[model samples]
Target: MTRSPVLELRGLSRRYGQTTVLNDIDVTIPEGSFTALLGASGCGKSTTLRIMAGLDRPSEGEVLLSGKDVSQKTTHQRNIAMVFQSYALYPHLTVFQNMALPLTMRHLSSLGRMPFVGAVAPGSSKARNLIAEKVGAAAEVLGLTDLLHRKPSSLSGGQKQRVALGRAMVRDPVLFLLDEPLSNLDARLRVKMRAELVALHRRTGRPFVYVTHDQSEAMAMADQIVVMIGGKVAQAGAPRDLYDRPASRDVATFIGHNAINLFQPADGMPGLHPAADEAVIGLRPEHLSPAATGALEANLETAEYLGSEIILALRSERGTEIRAIAPGDYAIPAPGSPVRLGFEPTRLHLFDEQTGKRLEVAS
Candidate 1:
């Protein structure tokens, strides 16, 4: 069966007065897929989310939900739910009430919401019971059934986040747009929440468009990652694809650990075969080994022990510095000692220094 895209942004752009915050951006979020908009601050990821949520008007372009244009729809008409960085729960309301608010607003009137009369009003009892059932189910899924009576202020950070998720889930949204939902949590909690989010997406089988500046969050949660820079998409692909085969130096440096070793290629230096305009060579730390088998050798500058691994900072004879991580059990070469460095020919990444674009190396 052919699946339609859950969300699509066609020529999407946002402008504030004289400045353009998001340029003509176009993207397709696949159905039931968890896609992340990954970028640093001020890169327009949040603006893009607002546009998707119908909270912000775009200067150009349209937002399509299930192949229909929702750009002109109001926030309430979109049927899309958002979980913000701040939980945004009502301070006075208990978790149960908070989760039930959306349903109550949809089904009950002002006169029907009063305490004594509300319970007896025609159809109010049935509606209230239905809302209660939905809220209870959502709470169970979020593991918040135990904290149903607690107010937002009384619950811990992670618990409050579960309440927020439960609230959004109760709405039965077609799409979930999360804007750094885990940003307010502590480091360990953030990791825990990341796993929960992945599991939640799997359980719901819903399309989730998540926005976050944290690369680790994107790497760990997203099935597809859209890397943004200067209000435009720098690159978008699978996390492992982006890590192993970056399209540019910007992408390579931004997505992974270990600073890449960049060097100008001389006239055919052994395995250092150069591509067109290939002045820079990029190699991951694991690609560089101390074994004397490949094309280069460098003198060890220093080594730092990191429990399970050791980071070696080395300087090539021609002044190209590289960092390599080896197993902690491996004997680290002493500083100032010359050691041979080996790299797989296919593992070598060539880049055009001027443009920082990846160059295809000939096999």
Candidate 2:
């Protein structure tokens, strides 16, 4: 079934004085989909997310939520929950209290929020019970039930993140926005949290807009990735689509784990297709490897042995640096030895030499 769009940004642009931060941006987030706003630092991805969450307004554009124009709505009025890079938990409050804060503020009156007086304030007891139930349910889902009594200062990085997520979950907002939520964690913990977040998204069944500069995180977590560069959308599509058919030279270099090897006509490598005469060719390291009867020849500079594969760095005859992946079991020749690299003709990507845009060529 095709889900309708839950959020849309049309002709969005942000400017501060004479400087423009975002330019004519258009993005669509489908219902129940996890969409990642991916880009490098200072590329306006965070600004775009802020606009969507109603924390910031676009200098020119409309933000639509479920088909209604919400450009002027406040963050509270949008019914959206946001989790920042910082855990943003209260140091003085226990996990349970932190998780319950949003519910108490929304459901209880100001007079009913006083510490001791709140207990006897009119209708406070009922709201407290409701808040407890919601907070408990959210904590259970996040596996924080046993640690609910601990303060933020006493929790590990991952635990504090979970508490933050629990707070957001209790709100049951129409949408969830996370801004680099895992960047602060250790590498191993970041991977673990990525899976947990995916599970949480599945359970909530609500749309998620995640802002991240890490391409690997975006590829692993999001169903849709919007790549922004220079304050404009460079490309937006599925992970496989972006990897297999990058719209431009910049995206090809950014989306892959190992930087892609780019060869210009001036390098003068042999056996290139006639189409390569006026175009720049890109080949991913994984798709290019050492073969006995390879078409391109280079001298091995170094080799890095990962558990599953060996990354071979080499310099071509024209001094173009290239990276290739070899099977873990493959025997590596000594450094400075000549190596022949081979790749499938179909794996080649051609880009215009002058404009850097991808060019389609017959395989």
Candidate 3:
């Protein structure tokens, strides 16, 4: 049996006076799952996160948590936590203090909150001790225990990132929102953090709503991905599902490493359709292999040698350029050499050239 979504966006929309930033977006985030909203900049991905976090109000829609309307709720009232790209830690505070700020603000009031005076006053000390225990547990989970006494400035980028994550984790919110939290880290560190985050999510068993423009990040970390384009959701599905069975040519090209090729059906072609004058063809680089003899031929333009694989860029007689990835150590064809290319018909994707929508082809 299917369970209700932990978080839901119903007809969510946002507009900035004359321009619409997000348009009637709807999505369901399952409990204890990771959902990524991915797209290029200004596609309203960030706006969607803000709406769910109650940091920004939707122009016309409702935000729901466990089927309860939360559009009218404020950020603090929604039990949502966000880790920002900048790692927004307090400069003057130690790691311990930084993580404890949320708890402190929740229990303590202004002016009467000196650490020494607050320590012994009524239930303040007991509350602080409880918060410290929770913070320490979160830090340990994030591998930040050793840096608890250190200031944010002393930590490395990765460590700072962990601290930011710890800060959010301490809240134990129903939903966790991360906005490009790893974007500021180096490539190697970003990759490492992705694995850590996946492990953390599994350990915590809380729903995660991650917003990122990096397709690779979204592909690697999310159980479900929502692709946004021009303020609307283009598609939503698992990474492989989106890659293999794209609903449209736009989605096919966006999520893959190589751009999909488009071809016009030739006259007298056996399988050509009268309505299919033009068709979009999607072939991944790995799908292209050197052919000894085939119905298709192209002139090798250039070859790029990666440590593990070689990529070939070739242009066909029809001016359609394609890419092929092969073992790098193998001999590569000379530039300008005419080469035969072959592909299984079943591997090819066909989409309506006019509408850019996928077409069902018989096996």
In order, what lDDT does every prediction score?
A: 0.85, 0.92, 0.83
Clashing pairs in 1: none
lDDT-better candidate, 1 vs 2: 2
Worst 10 residues of 3 by lDDT: 267-276
TM-scores, all models, native as reference:
0.93, 0.96, 0.92
lDDT of 2 by residue, 1-363 (tens): 388999999999999999999999999999999999999999999999999999998999899999999988988788999998998999999999999998988999999998898889999989988999999899888899999999899999999999989888898999999999999999999999999999999999999999999999999999999999999999999999999999999999999898998889887765656776678999999999999898888999999999799999999878988899999998999999999888888888999999899999776
Best by TM-score: 2
Off by over 4 Å in 3: 109-117, 264-276
Candidate 1: regions farther than 4 A off: 114-117, 264-271
Model 2 ranges off by over 4 Å: 115-117
User: Which 10-residue window of candidate 1 scores lowest in summed lDDT?
Assistant: 267-276
Q: How would you encode candidate 1's per-residue C-alpha lDDT over 14-81 as one tens digit per residue?
A: 99999999999987898888999999999999999999999999999989988899888976788888
The number of the candidate with the highest lDDT is 2
Cα deviation at 172, candidate 1, in Å, is: 1.4
